[model samples]
Target: MKHYDYILVGAGLYSAVIAWHAKQAGKSCLVLERRSHIGGNIYCEEIEGINVHKYGAHIFHTSDRKVWDFVNSFVEFNRYTNSPVANYKGEIYNMPFNMNTFSRMWGISTPQEAKAIIDKQKSEITGEPKNLEEQAIALVGRDIYEKLVKGYTEKQWGRDCSELPSFIIKRLPVRFTYDNNYFNDLYQGIPIGGYNKLIDALFEGADIKTGVDFLAEKEKWMSMADKVVYTGAIDEYFEYCFGKLEYRTVRFETEVLDTDNYQGVAVVNYTDRETPYTRVIEHKHFEFGTQPKTVISKEYSTDWKEGMEPYYPVNNEKNQMLYQKYREKAQQQEKVFFGGRLGEYKYYDMDKVIASAMNGWEALHR
Candidate 1:
């Protein structure tokens, strides 16, 4: 067997960056990806000349300058600001509970007018919020919560708001400005061509094998490298010794439409209970592409099962406690180092994932 300095598992963002840094340091790396494609969840498929976001809409946004510069070095990013709109039973409103949303909801213009209405509605929730329903009402008001928060949240978790823990929505962002920009991050955009370009550049010097399950042949892979960088699910890596951690995954139904445009925006969140899917994403709008045809994905948020791809971690108390037990066991593995969303069991943004990889690479040397 040809030995390598690092056996980077999962060719996701974390693994790709680690491979890049390892190659830079003149170290050999062997990358293994369980998925058929290289980009992991960030994988894009070209449909009708449009790069469709295979998983869901993954808009890269972050405040850290180092992380921003690192990705930009591989591929230049476009100025694609996420100004998503919410559709509640046919009524459209600007997202992030902005001034425009309040105006459309209450037919008011001034901040004072919107504030007064919200303050009055907030009075309904007197004591400490017992559930997500009360928490949202207390934060924004009943009108916004009922119209925007209620059905959408229920669909997301497959549970009524009253049954969910208050901490799930610790704080809801309410902006008085007319801005619809979702994230307050300093930098935001997608790769100029597509995300594949960035992934290819990052893993250019590495030896990668796709469609190989690292968990299935752990010993064989472990023998190939001095140290391992595992990015798969921590629980699965440990064979679910402490019981499986909860996660919320999404199902995407992608379609190549005949028309040039569909929703007119990159993202439109269906906030109504009747709408089965949470959001509709038009891939062309992400890069401002003037393609003759468009591709769209109807995103349906579902609870994680044994076979489904885990998208978001259900960071409830129970799951976190189980993860801690796994973490304790993971610490004892001297030859292995875990990183990324599934490894750390936290919902990490794209830039944060890169930052974690950068930090992990530095720690490897130490």
Candidate 2:
């Protein structure tokens, strides 16, 4: 039975940022997390002197200088670029379909040669692209599309590329340069210690209650706070009166290997139907650290269900319509504020989430 000026529903990055801002303004706050720990999906655990991303692979990338300065205030970020490699069967290719990948796929050294091959491949199509398959083929040509894009996109959405929308594969930019960096962001790195440390630092002076289901005792917490910042699913917050918005969930199979440096790179995506898992991530490679053993996880994207943890919001037309309804309802609620991925039903990287929190705080203050 604690009282505070504000109540945060989730201890994820969004809630942490809001609590940080609220505390900065001299307002008392309390954070209640359903899980035993903080950091939400971005939480990291240390294994063999390395930080393992417990939920999945999360890389911090942003172009906003304000966000970079704000996050750096809490913890130092190392120079880690996301240069993920793709493994189609036994062959390895550089990610983002860069020059290295082009060389590996077509034995082409110059950009002109690669462009010529792609033009020829694109000419084979008779008309405008209709679906994900045609769109990817038009953008990157046939060979790269089949070997890299096709199976991966199919696995991610649990549907054939031809059945999916063309917008889904509008353009996966293929850089002609030798750069293997996946993201085109101004700042990209991971916290030196771990994301867990960053979360702890953000909530330094705030009151936190873990392993507490605020929904079960909603009335009590509501009475304690003047305002509520909810980071959980918007539909769930209102008890799904308009039916559930669809989501594509991810399942991870993690194992600790006996040897060090399993899978030379940090992340290797399996973009073929033969492979059940989408990608394999060796956590230590992110920091290029040395250890006697390693831990790895194979990710599988599945259809969303009620009880499962929703990973990616399925943004098809149906879900969008449903989200619009929820948004209308959210606008009518005076005391509650909804932000973050689940609350907004939008896909967001870590930095985008931080910038969003900052924006929300600024609006609240104004």
137-177 per-residue lDDT for model 1 (tens digits): 99999999999999999999999999999999988899999
In terms of lDDT, which candidate is strongest?
1
**Most TM-score-accurate candidate:** 1
Q: Which pairs of residues collide in candidate 2?
A: none
Q: What are the runs in model 2 whose C-alpha is more than 4 Å off?
A: none
lDDT of each: 0.93, 0.89
TM-scores across all candidates? Answer: 0.99, 0.98
Q: How much is the lDDT of residue 9 in candidate 2?
A: 92
Candidate 2 residues 283-343, lDDT tens each?
Answer: 9988878899999999999998887888898888899999999999998877788899998
